[model samples]
Target: MTIRVVVADDQELVRSGFGMILEAQPDIEVVAEAGDGEAAVAAVREHAPDVALLDIRMPVLDGLAAARRICAGSRCKVVMLTTFDLDEYVYEALYAGASGFLLKDVRRDDLVHAVRVVAAGDALLAPAVTRRLVADLVRRRRAEAATEATPDRLAVLTAREVETLRMLARGLSNAEIATTLFVSEHTVKTHVSNVLGKLGLRDRVQAVICAYETGLVTPGAP
Candidate 1:
């Protein structure tokens, strides 16, 4: 299946460069290009692309706001782009339902791989980056009463599934979780799927956020 994508950025060079890189892939197609947030959302609606690559600081709407709208209204997945790996922006983007993010200077192969990862209905945030983003979000809310992961909600998960989620929240990939649990990667994938379904999460990114928000895992806690 071809993964249709929309590349949105204020910079003409960035837009063109990404389009060129992505279109070079056999399974990936650059369906549209947008210069700002509003056009990005519009392009997604029109093209119904599998993924939307948006610059975090676009004029008119910004990536966070665009991501919220796109995730809320369409089936398209969002990948935010930025020059900085700032925790604040990443945290906000995750909460806004971004599947992941990419740096403006991303390598060609990495950029193509990110779109494929998200297009396959999986999250794509780097483990280290995700950890920092989660920690930042949790720290900002530390003063407020912690909201435990809903027990009734978690009740649907089997013990193995719960363990899978914990591993996922710890930033372990399916293969890593499989190695830790001494199971096949395919089995781990099944468990991860179960965890997402039971939690009603859109993807692994949301699952990780849910785990943190519900206090199933704590930032920097060993």
Candidate 2:
């Protein structure tokens, strides 16, 4: 299936650059482009694209607001763009339901791959970068007391499912989680599906956040 996308950025050059890169892919199509958050939201409403690539900083609406509006009103997955992986807004975007985060300096192949990864209903985040982000959030909030093995919100999941979610928050792929648990990849996938379903999460990104919020996975813990 062709994955339709909308590229939103305040810079004309950035918009064009992403557009050019994505349009070059056979299975991906850049159906619309926006120069600001409002336009981005409008384009998503009009085009109903499968994915929306938004810059973290934009005029009129800003990417976070645009992401919130788009996610609330449309089914399009959001991939936030940033110049730095450590941008403070990265965690906010994840909380706002973004499926992925990408550095503006992303290489050609990584950019293409990010779009595909999120389009396939998976969340994308650089593991090392995301670890820092999560740790930072934990530090600022002094929520160390929040780390509980079984939070009320996660009461619906079985013990095995909770373990799967912890590994996910640690940035383990399904295969990695399978190997760690000495289970088949298919079993890990099943656990992941059940975890998401029980938590009512949209994707792995949200699941990671939920794990942190519920204290299933504590920051700075080995």
Candidate 3:
């Protein structure tokens, strides 16, 4: 299936550059391009693309708000674009239901791969970058007492499912989780799916957040 995408950014060069890269792929199509958050949302509404690549700091709504609206109202997945790997808005974007994020300077292959991965309904949970970002945010939230502990929200998950969530929060991919539990990757996928379904999460990103919010995983822990 062709992966239809909308590339949104305030910079014309960045927007077109990404469009060019994605358009070069045989299975990927740049369905639309937007210069700001409002246009991004509108493009998603009209195009109904498989994925929307939105810059995090767009004017007239911002990517976070656009992501929330798109993810809430449409089946389209969102991948936030940022200038920094550890952008401060990472947590908010994820909570806004973005499937993942990409740096503005992402390599051609990595950019294409990110869209494909997210289009396939997987979150871009890079252990190195994502884990540190999530952990840092969780720690800050805890310090400010802004994060109300709600570990009981995980009560609906089975013990094994809960274990799976913990591993997910640790940034382990499906295969990694499988190896850890001595189970097949298929079984790991099943548990991950069950964890998301039972917890009412949209994807692994939300599942990871849930695990942390529920105290199933702690920051700075292995």
Candidate 4:
């Protein structure tokens, strides 16, 4: 199936450059392009694309707000774009229901792959980037006493499902989780799906956040 996408950015060159790269792919199509957040939301509404690549900072609406609107109003998956790996807004974007994020200078192959992954209903939870960003956000929240552990929220999960969520929060892939549990990757995927379904999460990104918020996983812990 073709993965229709909307590339949104304030920079005309960057927007067109990404569109060109994605348009080059056979399975990926740049259905629309937006120069700002409002247009991005509008494009998603109109195109009903599989994915929406939105810049974190844009004129008017901003990516976080746009992401929330798109996520709440449509089935399009959102992947935030930022110039910095440690952009503070990334955490909020994820909470706003973004599938994940990519740096502005992402390589062509990775960019294409990210669109495909998110379009396939997976999160762009790269171990190095996602872990660090989430850890930092958790730390800040902890310091401010803003995070209250709600262990009861995970009551619907089985013990094994909870373990799967912890491994996911640690940035382990399905295969990695399978290896640790001596189970097949298919089993890992099942557990992940059940976890998400039981917890009412959008994707693995939200599962990871839920694990942290529920105290199933702790920042800087193995």
- The candidate scoring highest on lDDT is 4
Total clashing pairs for each candidate = 1, 0, 0, 0
Model 3, runs deviating above 4 Å: 144-151
Model 3 / residue 117 / CA error / Å: 1.2
41-111 in candidate 2: lDDT tens per residue?
A: 99999999999999999999999999999988888999999998888887788778898788888999999
Q: lDDT per prediction?
A: 0.86, 0.88, 0.88, 0.90
Give the per-residue Cα lDDT of candidate 2 at 133: 79
lDDT for 76 in candidate 3 is 96
Question: Roughly what TM-score does model 2 have, to 2 decimal places?
Answer: 0.90
Candidate 4, pairs of clashing residues: none
- Of 1 and 4, the candidate ahead on lDDT is 4
Candidate 1 lDDT for residue 40: 95
> Best to worst by TM-score, what's the order?
4, 3, 1, 2
2 or 3, greater by TM-score: 3
Q: Write the per-residue lDDT of candidate 3 for residues 111-162, one digit (tens) a residue.
A: 9999998998788887378777777766766677765454578889888998
